[model samples]
Target: MKKSMTMMLLLLVAMFCNAQMQDPVKFTAQLKTGNTAEGEIVFSGKIQKGWHVYSTNLGSDGPIEASFHVDKKDGVELVGKLTPRGKEISEMDPMFGMKLRYFEHSVQFVQKVKFTKPTYSIKCYLEFGACNEEMCMPPTQVELNKQGKSPAVDGEAAKEEEAKEEAVAITDTAAVAVTDSAAAAAPAALDTAEVKKLWTPVIDELNDYDQPVSNSLFYIFLAGIVGGLVALFTPCVWPIIPMTVSFFLKRNKSRKKAIREAIIYGVSIVVIYVALGLVVSMLFGASALNALSTNAVFNIAFCLMLVVFAASFFGAFEITLPSSWSNKMDQKSEETSGLLSIFLMAFTLSLVSFSCTGPIIGFLLVAVASEGSIVAPTIGMLGFAIALAVPFALFAMFPTLLKSAPKSGGWMNVLKVTLGFVELAFALKFLSVADLAYGWHILDRETFLALWIALFTLLGLYLLGLFNFPHDDEGRRTNVPQFFLALASLAFAFYMIPGLWGAPLKAVSAFAPPMNTQDFNLYKNEVHPRFTDYEAGMAAARLEGKPVMVDFTGFGCVNCRKMEAAVWTDAKVADLLNQKYVLISLFVDDKTPLPEQIEVTDTDGSKRTLRTVGDKWSYLQRYKFGSNTQPMYILIDNEGKPLTGSRSYDEDISEYMDFLNAGLDAYANR
Candidate 1:
């Protein structure tokens, strides 16, 4: 009996050891060239079929980003940013509250270097993490040789090499063939339909639900049409219409040919604008454009650009294209004959009217790029081109319409000044994006609201003829349209005044900072008492003999915030949460580091090291519940077993109240 027990104990120990050893990812590094003077180091990974690794440039609150660190050496100098080579797969990760890019199957990151010494070795290590559908491995570091060659002999080096070799031998020798029974027990891969469902964009993922891609495109097109109509009243474009049409009418002996050439000119304008959009889309792919929309640096740059354009529109300085270029195009129009001449004239007109049209076009591109769809910019340009072209075509078709058209006067200048105020107001929103992303407290919710209020109030006053700039006419009386616009502007300013307090300005919620940022508040937004730590929350639940509600949330999570404001605030839901359950709101995007390092081996036998608070909660959510999404609400008794099914983002009060009640009933029955 003793001998049999010993043998069984040995077998159990062997199984345990086998379970503890796993290497889902294998990394290899090599020099691009043999010469040591100037070369590139290429780091590549062969990820397991089911796993993926993140890119280096992930968002601030994302998963551990893959990175490389080279120990400082005497003669080696690092160069530009590490460039990743592969098709980067992007998805809106609820944990990060942003789109995350990752790679699967194979991945490569290349870094350039310059070496002055003839023979020098560089010591380097890489840090990365891998995750499958079920679980994630902690960030791992592997030391590699600079030259991608075997390490030189030293006492310490030899000992390390021996240990590594032993580990490798164990892994190789311990490999066991799986039996048919074991293979059958393993989980199946996701089918095509399941994969497709995972990739589908949810309504909550969209930034603008009402104005999704199609609606956004249509609205942008309408804005372009309105802009084109506004441009027709401007000094530069309005005067040229009559001159260009009359020139074609007088120069061409055949009226039919003149009409044909006029239509051609319109078509050329459309082609030029559409080509511009195509070039933009080609130069910057959809991913890049989307990234730029949320990137802090890009937002700052865009804000500055808008400020400059606004100043120019306010008549601080004209934003004309090079006079020489326009002059050259004008000369070409005079020299060429037939269709070519008409096209050149249209090109010249575009260049000459840059001061007026440039701001409008710049604003449109900025707006469309923020939408982050590949086709949005092209569609917007198409609409603007159509609007601009229609007027030229229609005027050519009926030359007599030009006679009854309204003349350009002070109203054009008023339009320009009004647009400047609007530009200035929008510019603050871009600046706010940078501020929020970087946590730069320069522009808070109150500050942004105050600035917008001031700008709009001034705009109303200006429209009422209360103030005049250098370019304004001496008239003090406001016209009927101007009076109405002024009234609307003042009304808008007044509407925002309530937002200074803790009122949720749902209308401007997208542009404004979150309500949590407001310092002084008459109304608080939080529905129930909460704890950020999971263990603490569980302990409290046990002490109170109540169930726990784990809320996986994030600061950047829009839908998470929306649910809190819309559903959790319902009277029934709030009462149950506050009275019955212990709520643990774990922000998966929280950047706070853990006071003490904690590491554990997952059930899959992969070692996971938790470095931050977010890492801890994120792992718990994924590992325990097999989910990585948020505002994920899971109810469990003190033992951490589920009382009811998990609840995700939903605004319906009735459904949410039912979910809470179900959890309560389940807990009571248990």
Candidate 2:
């Protein structure tokens, strides 16, 4: 109970820190009118003290480099790249693991655009990355869209209306521009201070309410501990514990020396694992981990690796190092003395247990590598090693405890087989990632669920002795623990049955394919994205006098699917989205080809071809909204004014209801 409370306290602290989160850098865009047909979009970024923005020319393998994109349209042409108009420092960035240029305090970037037509519209957006001592913010977008219109076509009518407006302006006597009777109701005008605040972008206000990214290190450490605990019960590690404990008791002259040496042995284990983590970090680093995890080729490779490990667990093969390595370590331990000997003994144990512990270590490292921080891998290793060493420490303090320990038996094989099934389940996650990345329809939501249902059901049957694997003892009777585990497996399979026809199944949403992937969805309260085009959705909302809700999502977004399964399924959220607002979903990862190839000036001014519908919508998202992260949500009125703040991947039901309700109130008040 005390441990549980400590865990809860840590969680609450994390939540509170997230609630008070603030960005260290802020950027705004303004259209400076230089001439009738051309103007420069000036992007000014105010970076807080100690925070810096990367320069515009870092290579692809480095941190996010600032750049601009001028979307291709008729009658508009980009003059040049986004030229930096501020002082820059050329130095090394630790997070980037390379030498590069960056700007501190503040910077200004400008892009020149020309309009051929007298009256025309054009869209442009800029992208950049920022970091401080601790954390690096995700790549952010800033939209700098501007347009021009021809002067009044009828001079007489314009003059008459202008004269009448001037008469009303005299009567009002206030400095505020009064065009109608509505302004006459107010007696006072805004002061200079208030006027300065009026031009702040609505997108910034929306972004101020974005959900915090919860990539907590504590949570990753907890995952490592859980993996280590599972490894403790495996055949190789469990049987060895008794012998290890007896050796320590018999070897030392006193209990104090024995305890000290055991402690050193445990430290050796932690050092070894942490060294491995450091090696991994040095090889690829945290900056590359995110891309490696999301890349389709990488996912395919990881999936195949897991499958091979699972095959070994199922007794198809044995994965082990040469016997000579362990024998050499044992021989060294006998020849050496003191701490070095004990360390060598621990090393021998690791080599001997490779067949069982290797897969767990691989999974743990893979899981932490995607967390986007250099320290994460080391922290994960520390947690796993500590958990693995706790039993060794306890045996030194109480040497006789191993006499009551469970002996190695077929039960350990049961644990091994259970882990094999789990590995198979996780392999699907990698496959799902690959499929979504490449737009393959083979692993749709229903199909993924069907496969899982069959797999888990077979596991349950095997646990109940209905079947046997290659190394299973013939006709062994099921024990109480095995029976309960089988029951759980079968129950989980039953739970997934409803997911075939579109039940949310929030439990498995993180692993299953998205609901949109399913061809049929009969969930009664489902809220659909009726408009895929942004302009059409806003136009419809204007006609109906309802506010617009735009869902910025991606085909590969796991959190988006989780939100649909968990939060959107709630009755209040569904009702608000379905009845009160026009819903538009913009998928940034859509793969359908566009009508023609268009040249793109990337963030670094490198030219690339934008040839897909996904590219078009992704360009629009950054060009108009100034955000690339998903699932991003924003509410706007018919006149294209923001109704409320933006939201991200958070699953708090009450908070979401308040978000929707606030938009409704703001729209009505507007």
Error of 1 at 607 (Å): 15
Best-fitting candidate, scored by TM-score: 2
In the range 163-199, model 2's lDDT, one tens digit per residue, is 4431100010001121122212222343333222321
Per-residue lDDT of candidate 1, residues 473-558 (tens digit): 78757999999989988988888898898666544554666565677767654585578877666656777899988888766555
Candidate 2 segments whose C-alpha is farther than 4 A from its true place: 1-215, 528-631, 634-646, 650-670
Residue ranges of candidate 1 with Cα displaced over 4 Å: 1-214, 527-670
TM-score of each: 0.59, 0.61
For model 2, where is the 10-residue window of minimal lDDT? 166-175
Query: For candidate 1, what is the TM-score?
Result: 0.59
Give candidates' CA RMSD values in order. Answer: 16.0, 13.8
Q: List the residue pairs that clash in candidate 1.
A: none
